[model samples]
Target: MPRRSLADLAPGDLVDDVFLVASKQSRADRQGNLYLTLDLRDPTGNISARVWNVTKSLADSFESGDFLKVRAKAQYAQGITQLVVSHLEAVDPARLGLDPAAFLPKAPVSIAVLTSQLRGFLKSLDDPHLKALCDAFLMDDAFLADFTAVPAGVREHHAYQGGLLEHVVAMMTLASTVGELYPEVNRDLLLVGCFLHDVGKVRELSHQRGFDYTDEGQLVGHLSLGVSMVEEKLPLVQRLLGEPFPPETLLRIKHMILSHHGTLEFGSPKLPMTPEAVALHHLDALDSKLHAALREIRDDPDTASRWTRYDPKRNRRLFKGSAPPAAGEGEEDLD
Candidate 1:
């Protein structure tokens, strides 16, 4: 049988396929009967599913990252498609005959190209100490491998394979151009800050099966872990420089990582206090927000409407009007 995509699912369709479990939760309905709620996904998209009257043994048999052989009936409800699962079982990849890559969303850019671009940005840094620090990250074969493969987040932004590298490259490119416009901003520091700001996500998220948080991710969070990663590599950077790295410079870089989230409620322990820190915060925010909005616009199912469904994260709906024509596309001569 041919494969079915989540995007093509509709009301009254029978669903029998392998899907990556994005999330799994046991809940109780009105009568206090136990049920399982799931976010099942393939590369095209995800859908909410519920297995009514689930048993404890069945719930204990699987997790958020496992592949499930699901048999369900689709129903449209609450403006979204959901599945009423009749049968579900954990399944091995080899038995399912499905490629894992086909089940997960990936960055639009290639990992090799993003890595090359990231290295190019790192090489552009002139400060010996900053260059050494970046080298400590970019030159480590193991770290670079993970950094290039991991997602920037589990959700809400660049939440796909190679997303971290894509986000970093975009931020660095924007920082380079924006830094030139603002001479007061420390371009090297800003660029380095972009590289280090989200590096801890390589550990914070588990992408081997699907994007999900690791135990350490939930306990310490990425911001704190990011600062620790920098501290761990500082001695290596100092050794590469053949001299003691400046205490102030190291602290500034760490500050940028710690405060890049921009606000306490948003997870930054400290507000952006330096010019470079402030620039990093805004630039990172711009990239993340734009990516999130674009993902919403692209994934929205209401093609009949001119605006996307309300994005609770962004607190607004995005206009879905066709993009304005370019200069030569359709404009008439102004004679």
Candidate 2:
């Protein structure tokens, strides 16, 4: 039988398939009985699950990152679909004939297309120093592979395979279009800033089995890691140009990367201080928040209503009204 993705599941459906264990926890109920809470995932999405009357041995059998063959029934509660697991067992991938690709979500855009667009953006940069800096990353085969595969975030944003690349391309496209509106904004700097702002996510996230933070990612975060990556490549960039790369220009680029989060409270050590930095921050934010909102609407299960379930991340309910009629759909043209 074909595997059913999380999106395919509906209330009252029976489930018997393999899924990745995104998270697992043990908790006691009001009756002081132990139960297991889990987040079971497949490429399309995840569902919260509960295994009541759990045993210590059952809890010890699996972990947050394991793959399990689960027997469950889908149920709706509090406007969300959840799994009530009756049986589950950790399974070895090779033995189950499971393909790893099916378990992880992927970006809508193809990797080749995203990589080509990324290279195109790098080539568009006229500043020799900036071009060299970009080359230090884009030209490296291993780094490019990781950058292409890593997600922009664990869950809040573009949290899927090839998501980092997609996020960068979206930001770069936005930067290009908006930069023309404000001639005062340095286009090359802003474009490069958009590309590099999340480059460190390549290291910050682990995508082998599922998207999760690395030790370094948790300890230092991407902003500082990105700064260190840029600084580490400075000598090579200087050597490529065969001249002293201007310190002031490098500092400005670094500033954009460090401040693209837009505020100190949002994990940026410094707020956007330069025109290009400010533009990059807003462009980045626009792409991320819009993507999050669209994903929420698409994944929302409340099809009976025009409004999506309230999104805690966005702090608002989204309108899910049908698309308006196309230009000549129903009424005859009066003119």
Candidate 3:
């Protein structure tokens, strides 16, 4: 049976359902029993799930990145939802009945459709240098396959199938409107930068079952890897197109990719130095944060007036709204 959400939970109910998600398992207490810190994400929203009651045998089998089916009771703590685990299983392929694909989060958009739109946007870029650079990178068969399917984030906005494409499209939308206000920011270059900025992420994430990082991804990270990919294409662009892209243009585009977060503390190695970089940085942040809010809104009303605890994604509480009474209808009249 499909698992019920924490919002749909009540005390003493037997939660026989399994929630497949990214997890971290660690040992604690006198007997070296274990506790689980889990990132519980469904299509609805993200929650922190806890699994307690572990002995050596149970602790030994529980590993991070492995799926676990938590049989637990729902409890609210400090305005957050938690599952008090009863029986936990390291989901064995032999008996697991739930649809695996349903568990992984996804953007509510079509990948094929969004990909075509993205390609159309790329085709429209007029700058020879920018268009050539975008073409060289985007035309790769393997990269396009991964890019269309990868998640933009592990959680947050666009953390589903076709998520990467949706995120890029959203960024392009934000960049388009913002680029108009700043006349100095080259329109085509800005658009190209916005689309290409996160291309490095195809290597950064391992999206097979759950979103995790490859060893290379953990060591090099996305921004550094992105710069390396662009440099790889630079040789090709120069060879075929001649004259090469001006060094300044390459530097500016790379800086936008490197510094789109606008600060060193935010994983950006440098600050946004140009007007285009500044616009790209905020537009990127804008789509991410805003989409997170939009997801929270969708999850809020699903259970109808019940509290959704607090969403860390939104940094506040979400609750279902009461339905308005119908015209000329009375609650007592129905009875």
Candidate 4:
């Protein structure tokens, strides 16, 4: 039988397909019967699934990043679409002629386009130190390869191959425009900061099997890792430029990386303080939040409803808005 995509599933439809197990958990209901909860995914998107009356051995048998052959029925509840799985078995994706990459999504824009845009932004830098720093990263072939391929996030905004490049390029575009409006804001600093803010994610995330945190990522986090990455490059920049990078400028760049999350509660150890730091924080937040919201609307399986499921993390349901009238149906004759 042919595969059915998670995005195309509707309530009451049967599902028979293979999916990458993004995550899996064993939990018990009030009566204490063990069940399995899974985050099943394909290239298009992911859906939550439940296997009731499961044994611990079965739940532990399949791990995240493994592919599963599932037989299930799609169901909708509380504004979310999920699968009520009847049967599931671990399978070798290779034997089934499935490449793991086929289950991962790619960025909407091509990597070539994104790489060009990033280079354009880096090339636009005027400050000698900033330009040198950006150049240091650009000249590193291995880093460039990962930076262009790693997802901006595991499952949040821009969660696909080449997503980091897309997010950085988009944020740089916003920073350039916003910098023009505020003359006091350091355009070079802000632009560079935007480019480097999430660079650590390239090391923090492993996209080989499925998106998951690396040991360094889980322990040290992207923010700290990002700071280290910059520090590692500073010496190379100095060697190339024949001088030590400015202390104040380095301080600010480090601040921007550490504080881009905006607040202590949000995992940023320090708050955004400098003008460029503040701008980078807000712009990063804006792009990431907007991307997530738009994706929620675009990928919500409950298409019959206008509102997406309540996102506990965001604390609100997105309003999908009324559909546009069909092409010629809404046209008024303008005399």
Candidate 5:
């Protein structure tokens, strides 16, 4: 029999499939017996799984990022679908002729298309110094490769391959429109800030297996890493321009990166102090929140419920609005 996809799993269903182990933890139950908790994933999505009364050796046998052949029964609990795993064992993907990409969620948008759009955005900047600074990062083949491939986040919005590129491009598109609406705003500065706000995530996250934080990522976080990255490129930009990059411009850009989170409570070291800084903060929040909300609505398995299950991070259940209109003749079906 063919393996069942995680996304298609419903309550009271049987699941015998191969999934990538996104994460695993061994915890003690009420009686001090060991149990294993895991996040199992495939290209469609992920499910929380539990293995009751498991031994320490069995829990330690497979690590996160390994492929596993799982035997489980699907069930819904705590407002989300999950699996009660009866048995699981690690499997070598290559030996089984399994393609790793099939187990990883990817951006709906094409990476090459996103790359082309990014280059176009860079070319459109009118400020020579800012343009040069952006180019300095883009010209580095190594950084560009990771930047285009890394996920925007681990579990929130755009948590898939090529997600960083997609998020940046979407934010740039928004900046272009908003800049025109608010004529006093510096369009070039805002655009550069959008492109660089999350650039540090490329270094902060390790995506070779599943997305997880690097040691430096856990220690220093993305804001400081981003500022450091900007500082590193300053001398390069200066040499390319045959003059010093403007102090004010550099300060504004770094401020935007450091303050994009908007508040100290949310990890921003400083609040947004400039017009561009304020705009970047709000724009970043808007894009990420909307993406996460939409994803939650789409992924909710309770088709009967008009509202999605409670999300602790979001602090509310999302309303499922009216169904989308059917496609017209010659129109592409979006569903």
Candidate 6:
């Protein structure tokens, strides 16, 4: 039987044996019915689903990332497609075979090329403290294995393979150009902040093709995990320098990492209190938002006519083509 994505399924349509993949889940509704939400993706795009409770506890039996063989009542309402779960089972290769690509998102370009650009940024830094920190990770076989090989965010721009390197390089380029405008923004510090802010992502995101969260990510979170990464690297560099890192310099660089997101509501513990901190926050936000706008524009230019909702982190809407003149006269009308 052909696989039916959540988007293709229509209201009240009976669905028979097929593989159902769960991408998200939610709390039970007021009617006491449970719901299983999923991202049903295909070669085209993804569609979301709302599955009502099942007899076998489909929500509990399978998981957010699990692939299940299921029977469903398909429907669509309010621009969303849904599967009312009738029967479901967790899939195993021995029991039910599936094409792995159906479940995971793919990258648009070669990750290796992006990774090389990240290495170039590290090679360019001149400050001793900033250089030490970046070099420690960029050069280490184990850390680079993790850093370049991971995704930058769980669900945002550059969220696929080699996304970490891609994000950092983009941020670095932005920081370099933006720093030029404000002489007060220390270029080296900003570069360091850009490179290390997401270093914890190496530990936070699973490098496997599916790109899931790691145990450390669930427990400590990337902000704290990044600080730990800095702490761990200090000793290695200190050993080579024949003395310890200067305390205030180390503290400031670390502070940039902790505060780069800009506010408590945004998961940053502290607001950016320094020029470097503020610059880093805006630059990071700028890179992600611009990348997202470009991605959305490339995906569908028609979206340009509509004012997209502002991205909370990046703070902007995306639009494409310029509007046509409203009920205008022909071209050569003089004032």
Top candidate on lDDT is 4
Q: Which is better, 1 or 6, measured by TM-score?
A: 1
lDDT of 1 by residue, 173-277 (tens): 999998889999889999999999998887788888888988999999888888899889988988899999899998998899999999999999999999999
Candidate 5, 91-184: lDDT as tens digits: 9889988888777789998999999999999899999999999999999999999999999998789998999999999999999998999988
- Where in model 1 is the C-alpha error above 4 Å? 97-101, 322-335
Error of 1 at 81 (Å): 2.5
Using all chains and alpha carbons, the TM-scores for the candidates as numbered come to 0.92, 0.92, 0.81, 0.93, 0.92, 0.77
lDDT of 6 by residue, 1-335 (tens): 55554445567887665442425656677887766667644434555555665443445676555566666676655434556666666667345555554455555656677777777877777777677777777668988877766777767787665777778888888888877888888888888888888888888887553567889898888888998989998888887666778898788877888998888998999988888889888878887877877776665423335554455666665655555566764567686
Question: Which regions in candidate 5 have their CA more than 4 angstroms from the true location?
Answer: 10-13, 78-80, 325-335
Q: Against the unseen true structure, what C-alpha lDDT does each candidate score?
A: 0.89, 0.88, 0.75, 0.91, 0.91, 0.71
- Model 1's number of clashes is 0
What CA root-mean-square deviation does each model show from the true structure? 3.1, 2.6, 4.5, 2.0, 3.5, 5.6
Specify the poorest-scoring 10-residue window by lDDT in model 5.
321-330
**lDDT by residue for model 2 (90-126), tens:** 9987787777667888998999999999899889999
Off by over 4 Å in 3: 1-7, 25-33, 40-48, 75-82, 92-99, 239-243, 300-335
What value does the lDDT take at residue 123 in candidate 6? 76
Best of the two (1, 3) by TM-score:
1
Q: Is 3 or 5 the stronger prediction by TM-score? A: 5
RMSD of 6: 5.6
For 1-335, candidate 3 gives per-residue lDDT tens digits of 44456566654555555566665656476876566666665534445667676666776775545567666666666554566777777775337555655667776788888888888878888788888888887778888888988898876678777888998988887777776777778878889888878888899988867787778889998998888989989888887579778899999989988998789998999999888888888888888887876676665533454555576645777554555578877746655
